[model samples]
Target: MKIAVIGTGYVGLVSGTCFSEFGHTVTCVDKDAGKIERLHQGIMPIYEPGLDVMVERNTEAGRLFFTTDLKEAMEGAEAVFIAVGTPSRRGDGHADLQYVFAAVEELADYISDYTVIVTKSTVPVGTGAEIIKRLEGKLDEHLYSVASNPEFLREGAAIEDFMRPDRVVVGIDSDRAKAVMSELYRPLFLNETPVVFTNRETSELIKYAANAFLATKISFINEMADMCEKVGADVQQVSKGIGLDNRIGGKFLHAGPGFGGSCFPKDTRAIVHSADDYEVPMKIIRSVIEVNEERKLAMADKVIKACGGSVEGKRIAVLGLTFKPNTDDMRESPSLDIIPALQKAGAEIHAFDPKGMEEAKHMLEDVSFHDEPYSTMEDADATVIITEWNQFRALDFGRMKDLMKSPVLVDLRNIYGKADMTSNGFDYTGIGR
Candidate 1:
């Protein structure tokens, strides 16, 4: 298979690289000349575990290439994936589809043969039909087909998810499109990975629904954590009790600062907007969005309360900045809300993350960055674990106590036990217990 993936953002880069690793020839195209140049020089625009090594090996094997020339990349390609970002619109919360539509319009001019155009970005339902309508007079009807193949990769574990997906959901209106897509995923077929075939609208809805549902789970557990705090019960035990059931199997049930990053926030908003457009109200999803926003903002109060009802003139140490670890993405991170609120409450912030400090420097204001976790704790009034990066799991309690002005620890992710922190002679507060 010869494939061209447009807009070399996270999904485009990862999909193109992984496709090449599946023994397909892939060329990733981006409009940004600097980004293309960086890719050629073996530099990645974003961080993902194991992605750089995979890109290197595939490029060395002559299976993957990157370029800024879209026409050149599309030449002789059997499939073109439009994996551009679909961020939420400013006011209406609808998916801003200008990028995806523009790519399709530009791509329509360069198709020379029968090609399958797949939407690998998470898009709203009926987007494929809109694309087909856009290309109606611009190109011959028989020359190309548009399909929806939404990505479901997690940020920190994208490569593993791409290679070993739970299932591949593809939506197509024609036999020709289905065949091309099937052949493109033949390797997965050989591995007996289930490839779900459905209509384009259904496929698009699947992505949004899955994300919104997962967001609901986070909100549910967070609400449970709040209830547990009031009732003098441990949310961890509550989560375990419910998660033991096969039907409610544990995933995204961890009580934390709420869901953030690229997918959940934007997708949930887009879906809620889409439902509104159809004159249908998605009340539960709407509540999920409301709860998550409130949760992020409330974390600052959690820290403030732990610091004796005021953070005035206090230096608080924050352990994580990225929404979740293993990626440097700072979009909608809980730290974005918590840190700024803490600063507003007169708390000077010291923060550290293994990979996110560089990006966080741009997003965060007036916060001192540290070289290591222990350095972040130096002379701080209280320490808060915002993201559960691997390194923060096991810490030298004695050293942490020695570094801090006051021995106060707030574990937002519930990474530590109450008994352990109490035994260590520190004032400890966790999410639910």
Candidate 2:
């Protein structure tokens, strides 16, 4: 299959490259000339594990192509995927559809043959209809069918998720479009990844529902974590107890500072807003949003209290900065809250991450960046672990103690056992324990 993935953002790039790895010839389009140039030079704009190697191999094999030409890229493409972003609109919480619409307009003008125009971005229900309406006039109506095939790729593990998805949701009514989509994902079908065939509206709803459910789990655990703090009970134990039940499995139940990334925050808010417009307010989801926001701020207070009360003149070494490990994405991360609050409390902050430093530098201001963990902890009064990177676990505790002015560790991620740290002559704190 010759595929054109428009908009070389996270979704587009990953989708295009992975499609090439799927034995399809793929062309990735981006309006940004500089980004295109960098791609041509084998330079990646974003950090994702195992992506660079695959992109390099595919590009060298001429299976993957990157360009700024929209019409030229779409020329003979059997399927064109609109993987553009639908970020939250200003003030309203509705997904801003400007980018997706703009891509559709250009794609409509360029289709020379039968093409399945798939929406791989997370979008609101009825967006497929809106797209068909907008493109039907200029588009070759007989040759193109609008399909919603929402992507469920997580940032840090996107390549793995894309290559081995649990399910593929295809939204369409036309048998022709369904057949083509099935063929496009035939390899996955062979591998037992179910192709969930459904209508466009239902598929869109699934994306929102999946994200909202995941957000609910995180928020639920976060609230429980707070209660555990009040009653001197460990939320980790509580989660383990409930997780043992088959009804409530143990995924996404780990309590953390808060949930933040490219997807959950925006998707949850947009779903809530969608429910609101229909006069069906999701009260539980609304509380999830509020509780998540407050949780971020509360983590700052947790850090303050962990350091023997006052943050004044304290040097805090933050051990991790990314939302989660294995990627450089710093968007909406809990570190966003923990850092600023620490700074406002008159604490000098030093931070280090294996991969997130470049991105985090712009997001977090007035913070000193260190080359290594031991280096970051040098002379710092306390250490706080924000993201659970592999290197942060099983670290040299004795070396950490030697470097830090005070041997206090606030492990927000629960990476280390309290007993181990206590016996090692350090004060260690975790979310619930």
Candidate 3:
């Protein structure tokens, strides 16, 4: 199978590479000449576990290629995936679809034969109909089928999710598009992966709804976290008590410094805005957005409270800056909100992360960044765990205490509980402990 993947961003690159690994001839196209050149020299624009190895293996076997030419990549391909970024628009909070439409217009001009244009980017509902309307006169309308095949890959675990998705959604208005899309994903279908074939609008709505629901879950848990703190109830135990139900799984229930990443913040806002435009109010989603924003800002205040209600002239060590871990994406990370708040309260911040400091360097200003955990805690007044990275789980507690000026710990992630750290000679505080 020959496939053209437009836009070599996170989704496009990983999806295209995985497709090539599955024995498809794939050409990943991007408008950025420098990014294409970097790929030509076996360089990757973003970091994901095992992606570089997979890309190298596919490239060596001639299964995957990178190019800047849209026409050249689309030639003889059965399907073209539009996986461009759909960022949040200013003031309106709608999904900015400029890149997706640009790809469609280019496809209209150069695509010579029947091709399935699948929107792998998460777009608002009715976007498929809009794409079809855009390509009405520019191409053989009968030859192309605009599809809504939204991706649900997490940033850190994208390749695994793509290759072995639990279910694949195919939005099709006709049998021709369904067949093409089905044939295109025949590999996954062979694995008995359930492929739900639905209307275009449903598929688009599924993407937004899933993200919005997950954001709501995070917000609900966050609110619970605060109450747990006030009532002297452990949130971790609270999460487990509720998560035992088969209906409510244990995923995303872990309390932390709110949900902040590229997807949750923007998708929640976009969906809320879309609901507003339709005159159907989603009060829960709007609250989730507000709750998450407040959670990030207030998290630093919790750390200050742990440090005797004032961070004035105090050195605070922060571990982990990426929203979660395993990916260097710094978009809307909790550290961005928490760090600035701490600085304003007169706390001198020292930060450390395994893979996020390069990007975090520009996001945070006037904060000392160290390479290792021990160094970050050196002469620190207090240490705060922001992101629940694995390395921070089992730390040299004695060493951490030794290096800190005040051996105090405020764990926003609840990775370390109160009793254990207190026993270790460090005055410890955790969210909802």
TM-scores, one per candidate? 0.99, 0.98, 0.98
* Candidate 3 C-alpha lDDT tens digits along 152-188: 9898899999999988998888898898888878899
TM for candidate 2 is 0.98
Candidate numbers, best TM-score first, in rank order: 1, 3, 2
- In angstroms, the error of model 1 at 217 is 0.2
Give the range where candidate 3 is weakest over 10 consecutive residues by summed lDDT: 106-115
> How do the residues 255-328 of candidate 1 rate in per-residue lDDT, one tens digit apiece?
99999999999999999999988998999999999999999988999999999999999999999999998999
Of models 1 and 2, which has the larger lDDT?
1
* Greater-TM-score candidate between 1 and 2: 1
- Error of model 3, residue 325, in angstroms: 0.6
> Tens digits of per-residue lDDT for model 2 on 297-316?
98889889989898999999
lDDT of each: 0.95, 0.91, 0.91
Q: Model 1 Cα displacement at 328 (Å)? A: 0.6
Task: Please give the range of 10 consecutive residues that has the lowest summed lDDT in model 2.
Answer: 135-144
What lDDT is reached at residue 399 by model 2? 94
lDDT against true structure, model 1: 0.95
lDDT of 2 at 381: 87
